[model samples]
Target: MITLTDVHKAFGAKHVLQGVDLTIDKGTSMVIIGGSGTGKSVMLKSVLGLVTPDSGTITVDGNDVQRGDRDAFLARFGMLFQGGALFDSLPVWQNVSFRLLRGALKRPKEEAREIAIEKLRRVGLKPETADLFPSELSGGMQKRVGLARAIAAEPEIIFFDEPTTGLDPIMAGVINELIREIVTEMGATAMTITHDMSSVRAIADNIAMLHDGVIKWTGPVSKLDNSGDPYLDQFIHGRAEGPIEAVR
Candidate 1:
């Protein structure tokens, strides 16, 4: 459903994504895992057209992302950012239905609220929570609201960035299960960027490890433990003595 070929991006003297090539099939979850500053986020932004790549091609369902109509292209995707990225000032319902409230996708406020409430329910949130602001919720609840918003538009593709970053272990597991269930129910194509090995094991059908601005390993999630790549081994086991060095 998505493809990137020879993608390259850099900011001034710092080169990130030297050449990233990946392909994600329809109705599957592909998780990209890497240490911080390895360009995982940059690759995602490139696909989203938020940060244009210097060179290469990104295509979604054979539509060239860089050259497609911006509005039409974006309508195909729903993204849950690292920080939840909710509007603190808006009530939960409005944040969940932000896309449906504007432009060509606009719907009656009541209808949008209903959809938002339904989506919130799907993410394991109660309708009562819909009237609250993001600041009124816990971190885990905020993440659920973000997930509800991402799926509110019924997008064919979803991007999850650091889905389990700042929550308790149990809450993170809950979110992971929720994500897996929703993706399966919708048969949506999913691409997630996260450093959490547990999250990868829980949510990924296939896993790709990025290093030095390119994919170093790509394989089935079940095979990650014995993938025979030292980098992959080092990352999964959290070993500090391996080839991957800690940034000073």
Candidate 2:
């Protein structure tokens, strides 16, 4: 459903993505694994138009994202940022339905609140949480709110960035399962970036490893352990003494 070809992006003196190429099929979950600062987030931003690539093409369902009308293009997808990115001053329902309350996608307040509560329920949050502010919730609850917001519009595609970050292992597992269930039930194309192997196994139908701004390996989640590539082996096993160099 989404494709990137020969993509490149660079900051003044720091080259990030270098000739990156990837394709995500419709209704499937593709998870990207990489160490910190390897441009995984940058790649996601490129697709979202938050970071415009210096060169190459990004297309969604045959629409060239770089050339298409911005608002129209963005309406087709939803995103859950790594930090939850909620407005602390807003109530939970308002935060979850922010997209529907303003801009061209605006809906009536009551209608938007109902949809927000429904989405929150889908992510296993109770309707009672709706009136609370984000500051009143725990980290896990905040993540649920973020997930609810991402799917509130019932978008055709979803992007999850570090969905399980900051949660305890058990809570992370719960979030992972919730993500899998939501994507499958909505038949939404999903692209996630996470370094957590457990999250990758639970949420990915396919996995791609990014290194030095390029996809070093791509395959089914089941093949991750046996891929036999030194780089893949190093990442999966979390060995400090392997082909991958730890950033000093």
Candidate 3:
């Protein structure tokens, strides 16, 4: 469903993505893993065209991202950012249905609210929570709201950036399971970038380890433990003394 070939991105002299090439098949979940300063985020942004690549091609369903109808291209994708990134001022229902309330998918407020409530329910949230602000929710609840919002539009593809970053382990596990279930049930292509190992095991069908600006390993999650690449082995095992240097 998505392909990046020799993608390169840099901010002046700081090279982020030197040459990132990855292929994500349709109806599958692929997680990009890497330590900090690796190009995982840059690679994702390159695909989203959030950060235009200095060179190379990024295609979704065979169409180059930079050569598409901007809004139409974006309409096919949903994103849940690292932080919940909810609009603080908007009520929960509005935040959940943000996309449905505006632009190409705009609908009557009542209809939008209905859809939002259903999605919130899907993410295990109570309908009455809709009228509350994001601040009123706990971190886990906030994440669920974000997840509900992401699937509210039911786009063909989803991008999850650090889905379990701030939550406790149990809450993170809940989110990981929800993501896996939603992606499977919807049959949507998914690309998630995260360093959380528990999340990696829960959400990935395929795992790609991005390191030094290129994919160092690409294989099924089942093969991750035996990939035998030092960088990946170091990462998955959380070894302090290995090719992957740990901060002091």
Relative to the true structure, how large is the alpha-carbon lDDT of every model? 0.93, 0.93, 0.92
Candidate 2 lDDT tens digits, 24-113: 999999999999999999999999999999999999988888785888788888999898999999999999999999988999999999
> What lDDT does model 3 reach?
0.92
What are the RMSD figures for all models against the true structure? 0.9, 1.0, 1.1
lDDT of 2: 0.93
For residue 130, give model 2's deviation from the true position in Å.
0.6
* Cα lDDT tens digits for candidate 1, 1-248: 89999999999998899999999999999999989999999999999999999999999989888885899888888999988999989999999999999977899999999999999999989999999999999999999999999999899999999999998999999999998998999999999999888899889999999999889999999899899999999989988878889662
Model 2, residue 115: displacement in angstroms?
Answer: 1.1
| TM-score sort, best first | 1, 3, 2
Residue 59's C-alpha lDDT in candidate 2?
90
Root mean square deviation (Cα) for candidate 3:
1.1
**Residue pairs with clashing backbones, model 2:** none
The C-alpha TM-scores of every prediction are 0.98, 0.97, 0.97
Stretch of 10 with least lDDT, candidate 3: 239-248
lDDT of 2 at 42: 96
In order of listing, the candidates' clash counts read 0, 0, 0
